[model samples]
Target: MVRCVVQSQWLIYSKHLPSISTAKRHSIQAFPLFAISGRGSSSHTLSADDNAKPLLMGPLDNVMPRHHITPKALFIPASSSSKEKILKILKSGLAQTIKAIPTVAGHVKAASNPIQEGSMCVTTPFGAVEDIFTAQDLTESHPEMDYDDLKRRHFPMEAVDSNVVYSLPDLMKAEKPVFLAQANFIRGGLVLGISLHHSFGDGTSLKTILQTWATCCRGESAAPTLTESTRRERLMSSETGASLDEFPEYATIPDNIAGYQPGVAKGEGPEIAPEPPQVDSHVFYLSAQRLKGLKDLASAKLEGSDWISTSDALSALLWRSITVARNLEPGDAATEDTRVLNIPLDGRRIMREDTNSYMGNMILFNNATTPLRNLLSSPPQLPEIARTIRQSISRIDEKYIKRAISAIGSVPDVSKVIMSGGTFGESALTISSWGNLHMDWGHVIGGPSERVRVSKIPFPGVCVILPASEPGNRSTEPNGVEVMIGLKSDDMARLMNDPFFASFAEWRCS
Candidate 1:
């Protein structure tokens, strides 16, 4: 099934631009140029040949608005000497990367058959570049804030101005640029902002492209392994199994034959109450200590069940905490049943396919539900809540993923019809984890002198969980997981006031 995944990144930080006592003065220059799509791959370059043409949107991409964009960012501290060279590499290699991942170089267009398949086509894709600002200007622009505060200010919580960078000309505005980038020189550091349409791909796809770009920037000759061989046709062909009725709508089931029932169905469920009009974004982190306590709490109640992951426990905790913040009553069965945790699981490594090099959206949601009363019980049943999430995730095995892929492929407008459920209703939460995405790997610029120290990204209305380095495992410690959430003003106020919720994270509100 075609999945239209949107992603973006906006990072604000200066490499080696700390206190004068710690940072040396460095000169900065800018190279802002749009990188056109290339046509071949070789040492120091990537080119598209077969899949280079305008590609049709997949079932996944059909769900969201064709014009919608997702923004994200990265912070890299580099030396003054290597900064120019780095930008040169990026400018030169951008074409190569696009050639390898043609979708990123393409833009959306009106599809001939909108009803049978998706309505947009990603055509003539290209990358746009812009110099945002220098480190001194970035610091001067917001002098009231501290270093950390400045980083938060530059985080891309929403869509950026595509026109300022790699936007298509009015005459050629057939579709959104599959990708747009902006480079901000932070004294001796650099911040890169990239925005992608939701229909293009998911986090995995974006990361894959970036990693490949990094490889090319470092002068690697290896071309990205595009596994579009026979799989492309399988995901696009009309199939009966992709029917919304046959598959569990709003939520997914472990097996098609099991017939497990969820609380809601596609286009047949009650609408969730409207969300509060005003909303704000906040970022919080779960330290190793608090995370350990949470895992222990969840495990305490497992009673010899299969192991639960840190992700499961945290999701349950957040679900429980949000329910409490909403002041949900402990005894309302109807209110309780609607509360759900929409956790998306990646299907790349699993299914035993060497699809690690594969791009586009490859994800399935595990919608776990529990009543408010059970979650907010006298002592709070953390384990049971965690178990529910674990079970839901467990159901996403080879059989389930294969079925989901087929199911997504079956529907022409899969996003609109299948899983048409709303998160606004019933206090539902959707969480995306970047802990395993390896975003920090090869995220260096110029030389190895300075690396990407931190990244600030939040899913405006949803939740994003990122990982830090593990304990004793210093290698991954820098990549520790942090949760970024955007909530209504009222919800944010309550969430911050709740000591229990506040204790687990440092609430950095924006």
Candidate 2:
């Protein structure tokens, strides 16, 4: 039997909040159904003011815009100190933090020369891009949503530029660092908004910077080891060796995909990705006990060298449960053989480099598919599902990473390659796991600091599995995983109620 719990309570709004003048104020949109989890007499804001000139960006930073200036927020539950004290620490830390991560303090500019044959080539010479730092205070602008409400809210809907699918051309032309941060105080906690362009850095890069900032807030002496120079040196080095096999033939274009002719006008994209379907975002917690049970189930079904992992079990369960929720089975002609999962696998380990060494976008999308009919009719074949996902990721070995580098080098505009790489829709699910990122370094704010309870990308239509570590067991035994899923309003409504899914995860839906 499955147990399902639902909560639908509306929260009150605070018309005004106290002021923290160190940070610039920016209006933030209000959200529905929120509550204040802790007690705070007043609210305030603080901005990071760094006046350094914008720095020129490398070719590696110009390829994909999918991650351009993203709004990523972390919920910091109220601490023992007053909100003002905490804000002051964050403000002071920002100054030091921005100085350390120079790239985030600059902006991206395009090539000045309009025409050159190899100009579009990533390895070819290009013009310089500018950069700078900016900050905002969103405390007064947005409606006060409870920490739990924020957790259940569809992150993409609340995120800035949630509709963007690929390439932030506007940000590039402006020659500004594809980064911004907004700080807001809720009733019982604080939401630290960190935004960075994909061109500036990847998830790993962001995590390093945030953790370092946290370290600084705690008055510790920790220097950032990752730098933009590291990324440039690795990519331009001949050692990577231009290998053709690295390119996935199916994912690449036969010719110029973005239609870039060196002498011609820059091509225009499809503008903003069509507004995502009206969707509801939900958060599901997988307790350690339930996590082991699912993995055990998968392991019990496997034989010989074939085995299942914790990730595999979770992925399989989500795929099957979603399929069942949609009622897409054998007799359902419209939905048979339509389920597909896109997993973004990190390539640093496969490339034989220190996994923690370089902070840049080093990942590839691996797609796995199983017919809906097969998934629905197969008598509890989760092991098979787990195996398919495992194989998909395992295939992205050293050879694949090298080929990807070669393919990226050949492309004039990499965004084209990224867009054409996979599918995204109701029938499709793209899951990116940051569980291993180890963001537990956020315990640097005050005396006896609390580690970041919830860290999320808040993008719509996609699922991001972030770290959920207990106070002390982070290094050894992680508490569990927090899965943030976005689906169309009707689809999400049904999915959260699906009995099979409810059996494993604890869900809170709005």
In the range 352-378, model 1's lDDT, one tens digit per residue, is 545555455555656676776777776
Count of clashing residue pairs in every prediction: 47, 17
lDDT of 2 by residue, 1-510 (tens): 000000000000011112212122111111111111111211111113222223322323433443243445555665667666766776666666655654445544443442211212111121121222223334455444554455445332233222221122353243434455555565555655555556555666666777766777777755645333223434322224443233332232233324334444232222233233455666677878888998988677576888767988898888776666556344664554456676766655566544454545555556687766656754557777888888877888765655455445544433323222222234656666652433332343333323222332232345656556334566676587767676666666777887767878886332
lDDT agreement of model 2 with the native:
0.48
Considering every candidate listed, which one attains the maximal lDDT? Answer: 1
**Cα lDDT computed for each candidate against the true fold:** 0.50, 0.48
**Candidate 1: TM-score?**
0.72
Judge candidate 1 against the unseen true structure and give its global Cα lDDT, from 0 to 1: 0.50
